[model samples]
Target: MTRPLTVALVAGGALLARRALRRRIGASPLWPMPALEEPVSGRRRENRRPSSHRVLVAERTEPAEGVVRLRLEGADLPPWEPGAHIDVVLPSGAVRQYSLCGDPDDRGAYTIATRVLEGGRGGSRELRERLHEGTEMEIRGPRNRFPLVAAPSYLFVAGGIGITPLLPMVRAAERAGADWRLMYCGRSRASMPFLDELEQAGADGGRVTVVAEDESGPPGLAFLGGLPAETAVYCCGPEGLMDAVSGALGEARAPHLERFTASAAVPGGAFALELRRSGRVLTVPADRSVLSVVRDELPNVSYSCTQGFCGTCRQRVLEGEIDHRDELLTDAEREDSMLICVSRCRGGRLVLDL
Candidate 1:
């Protein structure tokens, strides 16, 4: 009886040790995961995915009239750069990307401000009305695609809410003693965010220029001509302003652009997508995004930033000529993968390595 009890205890210990080893390997950053894991019972494992953090909305305040600033607190949160953004997931599962405008050194909390767009989607509206202090929310990413490049001089053009991402860059430039100038434009003083901060930064030196359309006419591109040829111009604003900046610069110099909106739709009618691993096919309409359709079939498919700016929904194109609409991916990344959120198939039928 004693011998049998000892054998049972040994078996239990071995089982626990095996589980601990598996957990350690799974958590290891060095652990290599296949592009597409082996299917279980002919279905891919979706729930066995990387988990996002649950942060406490520690504080909420109105910085501008219609803009709400949120201070999210978390433990051992990931570090982010100036232009990085975090995906704020709503209670209803809606995810919205907001730039991290707070100090990067502060790992305990993340600060993000969003302007309430009445005509736009419900993201900003939800933040304004629903989210509150002490609210627990899941967040993914602090990803950066609009990284500040080293240049002789910097020219930043920010319009209204577009200022969120560029604000950090301006602060970083000042700290590095880099030559940088910011041209901030808005509808009115009451509507613009971070005005006081910008004013404080400008007080010492006249590096910041605030232009309200009510007082002055729309910002003219005359300033563009005065800038040095090697100046790296970064612009984030409405489509019209971006177009004007691009047109003004011409081929002389290329300005780095960050769009708050998605790119123009892919010029195509309806197309069919085949989920190779799942063995399912779905039709995507011209007006509807591929993400919406893909979610209907595979409910657990990973996605964020429906605008195609984030590469979360990037799926391997097994056999399809992609329209490749997103600006986020590089020329090499476009060869095999596509952001299904905004991009579409140029061909009639496409296969995805789900």
Candidate 2:
């Protein structure tokens, strides 16, 4: 039998065995299943969460100009979905986020592409210039907020470095035999990574459009206009490209966007944040972030991404009002809680569960 058929047969047998065992146990008072809960609960209470994995740079290759592909050394790593990002703990103690660009089915190693920004905070530059093979670094998370949802067809639009996360999704869509098309836009052909792979994958009459900005006029909004209503559009790029796409989609189509920028700053005055645990009322400055204010007041508080993408700086809003600016929190999460990283108080005073 086929592998899937074998799996189905085993599952059916297991279900039958479980039903028979349950029937037999229903008549016996000494089955000991429920009695073992006490020990299980005790063990659960004692067990702590696993520590962050320390991954070594097994290999580093330059797939494109100003971009370095890093393969980390970890076989039994935690499972991660497409569009997931990992926080790399740099030597300078700076935590930087990078999208996982490798195949998610390959569990043996985690791969990420890093593009050195011209005015970046030295993380990418260091990775490109200084980091070498066998160098070890502390890695945390394969956290995902921009997950690929089920759609009849997909329209993926990526710009420059934004193609990193979409790479895996495209591979997954191909495996599932889903209808999808990718519009990868970059400055030039030489700057675009995985160009050869993308072209070869689509060589057998697949739909993949590579639009180089330097060689042609801007890809018009008409590109999105042709998409079917049943198709879900996914976009990731600079603010300009995102804005254009968003404008084209409007409220009628509502394309999903993964922002590479900080949340828009709200025009609001400063307010007081009351910590419920400490019974301390702290005044929040107009220019400072809630995470920064909290860190200044309470030095021991831990945080990873101050951009609110990571849930590390999350806090419950017990009372008062809030002006949420973080992209991490869902609409429901914003109603009950807040990400102190980017969110701020709306009214005069805000109460935090802390």
Candidate 3:
């Protein structure tokens, strides 16, 4: 009886030791467990993916007659690349994205230029009319979709307010001693923001052309025709100009365009969107945005920029087709999913991954 009891005790001790060893091995870095073993509680997990920062208005300057350059002061500003934009959450909770035109090397602050649109939405209007220096506002991201790609040479074209994103890229190119040229166009010099800086940067006899419509008439299609085959053309501007450029370029010489407005005028239609996880289907009116519909139906959903510039309200498409109107998603992403903020269903019915 004593031998049997001793044998059982030894077997039990070995089993416990083995379990401890297994636990230690699992906890080891070599095993590598996920940071969160379980799903984070609530929609906070989704909300946390897109980070937000607060910035104080440091200064405001009128670089041009209609353009207002805003300098924001914040130590916690996220590291951003050239061509990055931040979503500014205004006093009325309206979110709008502005390109970071400031020098990327300048860690002190981020700067953006806004052209007040008389008939446009309230975001830019509020900044122009109501907001001022020392005003505190919430800003999310230095998110960049229009990143500078490595090329042998570059051809940059800007129209009016579109120069904002390209400014940093131009500076970076200058710093790197890369081969590049810029064609900046506006109504006139007075309406062109950062004209002095642009002129000074090109003073070393760098290839930079200024085309004021009032002075030089509309920039001819020939301006783009002069680009070398080895050059990558990066353009940002109004729809008509972009469309003209797009029409002129062949497959071999297509200019990479960054559109300021995410949405174009699509035919108005009513649609039903099915949220898979939420198990809700909401009707989206022709006039209302998908973000409004989603937020109304599912109160827990989080969104920052409803204009589709920020990837905050991005959702996967499970079924049906989408008319993508967002700038954040790449061609592949747009093909795969939809930005619920601005994009809508095409076929009257759509399914989404909540």
Candidate 4:
């Protein structure tokens, strides 16, 4: 008489079962595959060594009241998509990224525009005042992570300078003969760049809506309810506008978002990090970053932006859980490495393969 407790499978069968289970787990969609490179601002860094090229400002003009447009020309310049951006190495060693707004087919030059922010970082002001026509500057990249995906219809939301990236997508959609609509909002008509162009596109009963805050205040969120079920939505704007759009769409159909702004740091206690090869330990304070502390020990380590947007400060994590705060690394990359500029330790002690 066989009992249920005494039943057993053959060793070979048990081994096959385990292997099949592993295969199924690996095939799961939730299982993250390693990204070839880190993604920044809804775009990924390509799996290639970056090279810098000198570009001349062929033309510069005030497209709007406080917005400046620049046509940067370089020899054999790489083409870019609507949502692609390039890093400009400023004269003062400050690196800033700007979206390519011009025609992608035009390989000789790239067009970019920036709105001056009086109360924000000085990069915009510096570019507006110092960089003139014929000014030569070094630039890196033309990466796109906010690429437009095919769908039956589309919705785009742009706020002020955020329109730079979406402008190209609109053109692409128009050329494809796809149904699309745009909700462009700004403080005023005079301050909005490309107002004339966008206005002209919507003139013959087109699908464009311009909401100037001075005239209509904040646009009502009721339009979100009327979107087609299969419409692909893209939004690049202020946090408030993005948040509102997200809330309206809900988790079921959230729009693809592009952010030039970094999210606020997570509130947590300070921690310590150990550099394995250097045999050095440093206490990271809440007020500072691991990059800053690490620089104190290894001053020559390369870093750029220092805001976790650029993958320049990525480091290997040998041991310990990470409190990832950057919008860069994917889950697979997070398993063994971290962007030291923004991420912190989930535990009290961290071991870095420095």
lDDT of each: 0.77, 0.73, 0.74, 0.77
TM-score of model number 1: 0.78
> Tens digits of per-residue lDDT for model 1 on 1-354?
000001012344444544543454342221223246344685433312123788999999888889999999999899777777877888867788788899887889999999988998788898888899999999877666677765545788899989998988888766655556788889888989998898788566567777888877688776576565656789998999898888888877788888888877746788888999999998998888888999998889887667876567888887889998885665656777888888898879889888
lDDT at 95 for candidate 4?
A: 76
The number of residue pairs in model 2 that clash at the backbone is 0
Question: How far in Å is the alpha carbon of 258 misplaced in model 3?
Answer: 1.5
| Residue-level lDDT for 340 in candidate 1 | 86
lDDT of each residue in 118-164, candidate 3, tens digit only:
88876788899766998988888777678776554667889999999
Greater-lDDT candidate between 1 and 3: 1
Relative to the unseen true structure, what is the C-alpha lDDT of residue 218 in candidate 3, on a scale of 0 to 100?
76
TM-score of each: 0.78, 0.79, 0.76, 0.80
Clashing pairs in 1: none
Query: Tens digits of per-residue lDDT for model 2 on 232-285?
Result: 688888889888988887667788788876757776688998889987889888
Q: What's the lDDT of the predicted structure labeled candidate 2?
A: 0.73
- Whichever of 3 and 4 has more TM-score, that candidate is 4
Go through the candidates in order and give the C-alpha RMSD of each one to the true structure.
17.4, 10.7, 19.1, 14.6
Ranking by lDDT: 4, 1, 3, 2
Q: Better model by lDDT, 3 or 4?
A: 4
| Model 4 agreement with the true structure over 1-354: per-residue lDDT tens digits | 111111123455445534553454343211234346444675443334335789999999999999999999999788666777888877877778888999887889999999988887788888988899989998887766577765556688898899998998887666555556788889998999998897677555456788889988886666676565667789998989989988887777889888877777877678888999999998988888899999999998778777766667788888888988765554656777888888899889898878
Model 1 regions more than 4 Å off: 1-51, 269-272, 280-306, 309-313, 327-335, 346-349
